[model samples]
Target: MTSRSRHTAAALALLTLAVACSTGDGAPAAAPSGPPASGRAAKDVHVAFVGAAANLNFSQEMMEGAKYAGQELGADVQVVAPPGPDGQAEVGLFQQVVATAKDGVSVMTLNPELFTRPAADAIAKGVPVVAADVPLAKDSGVTTLVSNDNPAAGAMLADAVLTRLPAGKKGTIVLGVPTPGLPVLEARLKGMKERLLAKNPGLEVLGPFDSKQAPDDNYKAWSGLVRAHSGALAFLDAGDPAAFNLPKIKQETSASWLCAAFDLNDAGLAAIKSGQSVGVADPQHWLKGYVATRLLIERALGKREIPKGFWDSGAAMVTEDNVDEVIARQKGPEARAAWYKKLIDEQFADVQGRMKPLS
Candidate 1:
């Protein structure tokens, strides 16, 4: 099915589930008068999950987490995204959700500034908003931010690259950014360059060249860069498309440059297993989605006060040593949710304690 059709089907299914779990008056079914009830107080709550692009693997992984959270919490989670990274289109969707969402909305965007006003308005209208993946500004009026520490993840990627290079190696490394000027990507690139230079001043870091958001265009951009910089020591990317495409390019061209990027798309995993790329810096997208939705549900149910700051969703590095384990954990939505159950319980148990000021 087409991407739009898939999104429609998923939303409809979640809505149907929500209705089935509600009472005739459209209120959540009352908990049984016995021992403490399981955590399904959000039976009729409707939460919206908005993403920057529907076609990207990172976004799909996040949607999976959102859907799984709905299943676990008995909430209705509707997912939507633009076909590509169109910030304007994403802002429009966020505005619409803010006006209509019954419970709350969680949005992941490349352009957080575009969302500031709409998010503030949503908060004023009693609709909570959580910034997922890319964080909004400190005063964006979002209930909380669930995302990886992008700069730290970037430095981690640089450290991974450093392992592949010899000490005092004097060579070039190219950085590809699927969306230039994106706060998260720029922060990651900044951290990476700084780390790389600090560790190996002899290394020459090249452009965070614009690797377009569309898959086809992104591949083309990486392919052109590889061809133009045949002698570069390594290629690192701050986006998902490159994680999948760079390995393909490396294999097809029989290039010797080390390749690494962010995200754990299937192709990228395969590349790691086959030793085509060094590793991927995982932003834990699924966890971010689940945390955002769960927080919104808790707020709607009056179970908890959603924190108003940055909640570090965490990050990881997927390499040959742990690729199989990561693959097993990601076998399906249920498996992914189960794997994160402990972490979720801990974080939700002390939401405020886990949050740090949004910097």
Candidate 2:
């Protein structure tokens, strides 16, 4: 979904490598000071996600994670974004972030080569940067990456479909994708198509439609496919855009179809709860933001050092049966606080604290 920001399209065009967020009240509120355990307080640590827009479930949740970590670590952090969905647009936004970012910058990269330079420049200049979603190029002299294993998660979605369909049933499947070149999205499509349709001559497959088009275009494309292929059994979507509209499309077109896609938001969870869709691959984007912010602040404050490598930001499966659990765990301050503690324990328990070339 796109937002109408005050940022001009012309200004959005000049973006190049990018980077972090602010308080809930839209003010620059630093963390409240307390006993300084490290004899150093973390202040002015900025964490940013590309394509940040109001009410965007993924980015918004990530910002909340960062804010939570900032409060815990006594870090003054803020989140920022650029007009996006366009990779190049993020590059311009990141460059601007680097120009004035504070003690540390936690960034999520999209366009690799374009992003590497600015992020690298920040790292070179003594501003610690942590990458999430899509990490900076491995050789960029930056360390720490937080994101789901895309292809593996894609494989898991495909597995969910096979498990859901009745045995000996061969049903037509439709694949939906938002855009090309995004490694995660592309990996999802690649993994699904290869596994779901392998040597199944009786199975029919539809277009990996260019879903990056406007919402109307996506609705048109998806509704048309669902109608023509009413017999289709599984709608395997590779991006959130497809999943966001699938329930509505099926509802309006009177097509009851099994579907799967990446990410989960309130509406998406509702779709699952209503049985309008089956499962979604949850990348735990909030964890990425929270962890990235925490790590950046610790490293910036000289309280800790991040091991240089991928952090394998894990994923989860959300089906109707267990969707309620995810819904509950992600709500309220108490639940999130508990979830963050478990995450830190599971992900950062043991490490050699050394840098190695990315695998």
Clashes of each: 0, 12
lDDT of each: 0.81, 0.66
Candidate 2 per-residue C-alpha lDDT over 237-300 given as tens digits, one digit per residue, 9 for 90 to 100: 7766555678877777777678888776777888888888887888787788877777766655
Task: Write model 1 residue lDDT over 185-270, tens digit each, in one string.
Answer: 99899989999999999999999999887889999999999989999999999999998899999999988889999998888999
lDDT of 2 at 348: 52
What is the lDDT for 158 in model 2? Answer: 81
Best by TM-score: 1
Off by over 4 Å in 1: 1-41
